[model samples]
Target chain A: MLTSATILSALLGGLLIGSAAGLLLLLSGRIAGVSGMAAAALRIADKGPPWSQAAAFTIGLPIGAAVVLAIVGRPEVTITSSVPLLVAGGLLVGFGTRLGNGCTSGHGVCGLARLSPRSLAATAAFMGAGIATVFVARHILGAG
Target chain B: MRHALPGLVVGTLFGAGLALSGMTNPARVLGFLDIGGRWDPTLAFVLAAALVPSALAYLLVRRMERPVMAEEFCIPQNRTVEARLLAGGALFGIGWGLVGLCPGPALAGLAFGVWQSWAFVAAMVAGMWLQRLYADLRDHRPVHFTG
Candidate 1:
């Protein structure tokens, strides 16, 4: 249940994330919102995204993680959620992120940073719902 | 190549950050959401810390004539908090609470070789496709994603 809050590591990691986001914004003039990128991945000409940068950024996420896994250690990813649950969750996440027009990265991080009201509203709604869902699952449903 | 290079570098840095911050760990994310239980404040720190640089970057955007690589900073102009936004956010939260993996972490989690990661990502993509199809039907046109 309760674990030690690694504040320093989170802070450092967040700074790196923020820097990366900032770099993207400055260099490529794009918000580093993963959901948006993934949702529109196959829609080659429908949208106005620069496909080259989007493709490279999408490809690099796993590469960076693999490097960390090799050099340091794998991030503790002991997921016990059933395949059914995972699928349901993924479907909801995918549909919802697209519907809302952003996810944690887009709304929670990038949106908040830019002081966008819509992002703020979306983030608040998600955070509130996320907390409520966890409570229901853990306390009521007896699920993880 | 220049365009691709910057994106690759940025994505790498972002992936490392997600891993190093323990965002890649579903447990850590769930723990943060475990407010009535054993709550963790690590996510808060990460969100707060992340805002600093991006906030500055946005401010800088105001002053710059144009971005280095792009013709213009490609930010969408959706200001209102519409019903779709709230409903979609709530739905996403439910899924996130169930799995503790969002898009960013899910993509990055591919490196961890977890079955859950694969299942989640595949289903997520399918869901996105479903949503796009639904949107197209609603508008009677293939909607251009401005996300």
Candidate 2:
């Protein structure tokens, strides 16, 4: 089912992500880590340009998606999990990202680009965990 | 002031990228994660494509003395491969596998106005707050040792 169109779109999308991250770093000298930025925006103790910048970036996420919807049409999303499950998952993601100090964007995309050993280790750990969880959820638990 | 515009622009582009890459779709993301099942390698392509530009960007950064808009680069300084990193990454991976939604894609998906996205964001924020509280409590706890 992996068609050429799918490959092209994925590549194009990734290029955009990389460009955006690069732009942020080149212009503002900041890592394009979504969780870190979101947390910084919410943290009351943090002040000034960094806070405002983070808030702006957080606000822009939805706006960009809106633009994509207008231009390219909305992507189909179906959540089969119950609300409770969803909440639990969300909580873990939020907590883990903060505790780990990065996520896919920070560690996977940007960190890998820089060839940082820590990021490499984090990426491998998360990928392994993710794969194992998916196997258990889909195969063993039958909770697709 | 200057930082705001660039931040917004970068965020917008990043969100757009996520949407275009099919990351906004939970099913597709789950498919990518499901290695034993009907695994999808589209995300791998995305990662590879993203690396090209980002790698070049780092090279560009190496040439610059400072960011055009900031006084100094605010890169992460910690290089330790601590237990926290591994544990937190594992936890995050499990959550991501369960929901197929990470922070960036979750935030970008908010444009759909789905209750799931809203709920996830709310829960994520609360979790972050809770972690901060725990960290604070740990810092303030009195050390007791038995001689």
Candidate 3:
């Protein structure tokens, strides 16, 4: 059920991310593409502000979520699967973001809007893989 | 204000829609994905609602001269379906299925301060780092996908 709190929170949350991405461009001349930022940070030439922006942007995510929880209370998180599986899943996602050249945000939102062919393929890949994994996890592994 | 500003505006509106539709709530998303343990079908409506805005945006953009940012209009190009592509897609899918979150909604969910989301984002960054390294080793130039 969609509550008023949920609606308000989402609106505010979206504003923050959009604002940050906008401010980055309006001020510094950069796209808030997470994969691009991560790539820049890992580069040997990376120094000063790029690293900071990447760190700050990455850090802001959790802080923002925390702020919401403080206001609306925590949601119950249940994981029936083992920790190893979860960690493995995380590692795979890391690799995928790299291979895909972007994650959901970079491709689904940023790339797609740009109408970048790469983003389209990447987004399709994102959805296709997600659907396949769900099918396998539910029917074969019985993980869900 | 011409380039990313509009994108930012569109993104914020999209984010708000997700939140209002209850798609941004991790628990609701988890329930939707669960399939067996109290399956929630509310996400269907969210998806349907989103189609309107998505279609409108596409129509608007199609009529525009190049986007306000770049030298030319952005268009996807890479079409070769290779091994790396398949592998990467599979991995991303597995993570999404397990966690019930993706980067966009995950970032939005960040407003809630979930430790798991932190972990997920951290892992996402690490993955990006590894990929950059691999790309650098494989090619002298940075991987620039035109498509």
lDDT of each: 0.85, 0.86, 0.54
Any residue pairs clashing in model 1, and if so which? none
Give lDDT tens digits, candidate 1, residues B7-124: 8998898888888788998888988898998887888988899999999999999999888887888887779989999999999999999999999989989989887899999999
Q: What DockQ would candidate 3 receive versus the native complex?
A: 0.23
**Candidate 2, position A133, lDDT:** 95
**Candidate 2 residue lDDT tens string, A7-114:** 888899999999999999899988888888888778622322387788899888888888889999987777776788789889888888877878999998899999
> Model 2, stretches more than 4 Å misplaced?
A44-49, B141-147
Candidate 3, number of clashes: 15
CAPRI tier of model 1: medium
- Give the per-residue lDDT digits (tens) of candidate 3, residues A40-133: 4445223223455454554444454454455555544444435555565566777786676566555654555455666677767766676666
Q: What's model 2's lDDT at B106?
A: 94
Residue-level lDDT of model 3, residues B1-147, one tens digit each, is: 344334434344434434444555545665566664566665544543333333344455556664445444333345565667656766776787776766556655556555665576666656656665677778887754321
Per-residue lDDT tens digits for candidate 2, residues B60-137, read: 989999999999888776789999999889988988888989999999999988889999888888777766666667
TM values, all candidates: 0.94, 0.95, 0.63
Worst 10 residues of 2 chain B by lDDT: B138-147
Cα misplacement distance, residue A63 of candidate 1 (Å): 1.0
For each candidate, report its DockQ versus the true two-chain complex.
0.66, 0.59, 0.23
Candidate 3, residue A36: how far the Cα is off, in Å:
3.6
